[model samples]
Target: MAGREEQLLAIRIAETLSRAAEAERHYVKIIEGSSSDELEDPNNDDLHDAEELLAHRTRTAFRECQMLAERLHMPDFAKDIRKKLKAYGSDAKLTSLTYSSTAGEQYCPALADAWGFYEPMAAVALGGAVTGLSVLETMLRNTAKIIEQAKTTPDRETQVRDAVFGILDSHSWTRAGKLRLQRALKHTNRT
Candidate 1:
């Protein structure tokens, strides 16, 4: 029975990872498609439309990632991930994650690796965001900081920075990014 339970847990973990991957892919598609557009074109409705779609998809992906992470028993992964992210700096990484292709490729692997390391906090943060918890904004800002840290630091800092970036850049919580922002504002309003 214990062996069976372990197998079940493993299966659940795999499924959650798969879902997170799918979310990342969707985010990638949005990013790739957005960049392919002609920025100089006067009739750039497609770009705008694509941006909107990307935002929507990002949110959906984030919510799903949060759900899956919660299922995997790593509840506080997002929060811890946020803490690690704040250690790095948020703006630099956020710009890179959204704008730089080379940065994306280089940093994405680190971000993904970080996800594995800090899955529990991430899961909790994501869950709180999805469920409309009061703490969502604080979580998002912290996550943004984590992404930044992953980008600019060196050595061990770099490792943690990359992991944080990977988790943010991944499709796992693209949409959650915006939701987190909203939550942050909501949190401010209450205080």
Candidate 2:
């Protein structure tokens, strides 16, 4: 009988393989929807769409295989995936931007204008613009400083930033106050 760790590894491998197979199916569907002759046309929208679909599927497959390789302690296999992705002109390194759209679902004019640049001063300013002016300003300044100075992993930084944003969004600030904060957040690129 397989040991517990072995069993878990096997399960992970199976799941990853399943996802890769599903991605392959989607790739096939995209190819089948477009004729080869049409794909040869430089101005064909279908050709561009097919290329985009294929690239997405390739990236998805690479991620699944790379993850499985890492789980199985196969560093070489992961390296191979990275090489393949590079050959295909895709970035193998993963970041938040890779998996998410630039702007979130709810549109903020300030954020849109700034392309989501964050400024610590915005939060500090928000503190003084509200009813709990002094207290909020002090708290925001402290929190912002902590976030900026903390030596943490990229994922941890993302988590902290998300939490801060959640608090700001959920707080009972006046509409104008919120707008001002959003504008501040967008305008300045200070860390």
Candidate 3:
């Protein structure tokens, strides 16, 4: 039935979005880790270049997936029912990920709790289009804060360990994430 078809499409779109989010998160992690020369190596220009390329590719892929999901009219569902609704003409161009939309707000909190990144409420205020960037900045700020706090606190190592693990565990591996991870790991090993 048409309803069933729509439902399936919606599920597909949701899964795709989830995958894209996971990939984006992973790339952010890699970029954050590589950004510090002292933690890594100041002279490793090639590694930095490769990380930048991977981050660019990941962002492009995430945007494409989001656009495709919106274009497919996959998010249309029936009211109060677990069925897909018929797509109106305008559905194709509609995106739930709009800056002012509820869905956009959801990403901020999820990112904060899962990755220990930016404050969700602050990110939501900045708007969704740049939510990813905002979150990244928040993560960097949090990292700097942690370092500063560690200098004054005796439990700095434990706090840093928890923060790192929070990021790693909150991230779900998608196809793109896996590919990037493999490449990064290989590159790391080679160096």
Candidate 4:
């Protein structure tokens, strides 16, 4: 009969394998979605969390596998796996829509001026066609354009405030996102 320690190790391995399989399925779905019509719409609230979720799941699976490798007395292999996973996570994040859009937000005028070049990558990150612009890309591009246009006016701050309020009134952003934007606007106006 197997010892208690052996049984426990087997159980842990089984659980880790199960998790790895699930993560693989998730990754496959994301990849397939990129080429299929089933890709999520840009307005989906889930899109807001996809990048973090993907990275988290991938890291979790790799960590579990690394632990298993260490348990099997393969320290060097485990360390190598850790290094590779870290590098992959960083690379994936840089290409993600969430990262790209958030980075663009930091320089709205430059992003607006270069939007055409950015749109295709944004679409691909959303699991859509590389040739088409995702709705999220369109929205970000429009928002940047608004900021850029406001920059040309004498009363630029007021114009930006009005434009932001107008968007809040007219668009259909997720409630949480909209609320966050509203709070940011109010906070900035106060300072």
Candidate 5:
């Protein structure tokens, strides 16, 4: 029962997240399928385009989140988040996968530890982590910080968290039957 504004924001976030995930998957598949297994495209122009598009699209999530924060009246939070995300763009940190979300900063190397160009953190999750906090925990926390820092009236943190979690739980971010978690966790613990 979200308000229209929150509903719209959630839809926007979901779409942006979906687009980013698609781009990452396309790029990762190309990287993983390459004969050389190097970060290079291996004479594949499509792969190069996919790589460029991933960077562009991934960085764009920041803007969409920023805009949502503004609508939520958290200008300072949006600015801070954008500042941190600035380095992750295609123009910066070329040939690597990097992510900074709430709870901590995470890194995904281009020629990574067996994952190659793809970073698992960039699982392109629409929801938060299946195993832990939300995928955008750090970004959302950054948004919350604006309220704390600005000394805004009333407590909006609960609403923010609820809205975010609710949006994620709405199932727009997950593929059908992919929401199963306990089994995945058992397998992960074994490794």
Candidate 6:
């Protein structure tokens, strides 16, 4: 029989795993539909779709915190969320995370406005696809570890910079390099 602490951890792990599975299915579906041209679309909402997925995941993470607080009878832990969110009041971008997007739909213009580099990023051909998949994998992995272990790991901030460097740090546009990355998507179906 699990103790209360163990039960809380188990619930947190279950919630995290559920969100990861949901995100995987959503992204895998989108990737299956992605053609080379889809990335090139001015309305490329790949990351935006991801944002919606993550917004839900993020909300769930906070909810898990509240769950833990409730189960443990720690009022301060639950109250901290409001204080933390309030701290971001000046930066509306950061503050907006408090609002969850229920629709699970992509708003490309919002994505573009939020990202500012979406269309340009989309034009990177296979580089964009490979990089996006890699980043998502890293993020999901870190998120899992964070929830399961309740430890703060350092790599999340560096993931994007590292991914971009991994994709572009090489020499030139060679057939071999392009082919290598294209091969990474072999398991994926692009229409």
Scored by lDDT, the top model is: 5
lDDT of each: 0.46, 0.46, 0.40, 0.48, 0.52, 0.45
User: How far is each candidate from the true structure, as Cα RMSD in Å?
Assistant: 22.4, 19.7, 22.7, 22.4, 19.5, 21.7
Using lDDT as the measure, what is the rank order of every candidate, best first?
5, 4, 1, 2, 6, 3
- Is 2 or 4 the stronger prediction by lDDT? 4
Model 3: per-residue Cα lDDT over 1-191, one tens digit each: 12333344434444544554664455445544655654378566654454444334333333333333343343331121111111211222211112327543322222222222112212322333344446546665687565564464436544654453355446763657545644654586678
Model 4 agreement with the true structure over 24-108: per-residue lDDT tens digits: 4454346445634445566444433444454554455466556545655567866866775665546254223322375542211
Q: Tens-digit lDDT track for model 5 on 1-191?
A: 23456446656666666676677667767666677745544667877787677666656656666666566566786676577565544543533655546525333342122122112222332233333344455535675564455455545545554444454566565643234443453475589
TM-score, every prediction: 0.28, 0.31, 0.24, 0.34, 0.45, 0.32
**Judged by lDDT relative to the true structure, which candidate is superior, 2 or 5?**
5
Clash count for each candidate, listed in order shown: 27, 0, 0, 0, 4, 0
Worst 10 residues of 5 by lDDT: 111-120
Between prediction 3 and prediction 6, the one with superior lDDT is 6
Tell me the tens digit of each residue's lDDT in model 2 across 34-125.
Answer: 67776467887654554454445445545555554565456785676667556545321211012126533222121111111112212322
Question: Candidate 5 or 6, higher lDDT?
Answer: 5
**Residue 118 lDDT, candidate 3, scale 0-100:** 17
lDDT at 77, model 4:
63
* Candidate 2 weakest lDDT stretch, 10 residues: 110-119
User: What are the clashing pairs of model 6?
Assistant: none
**Candidate 4, TM-score vs. the true structure?**
0.34
Error of 2 at 59 (Å): 1.4
Best by TM-score: 5
Residue 148, candidate 1: how far off, in angstroms?
A: 58
Q: Which stretches of candidate 5 lie over 4 Å from their true place?
A: 1-3, 37-43, 89-95, 98-191
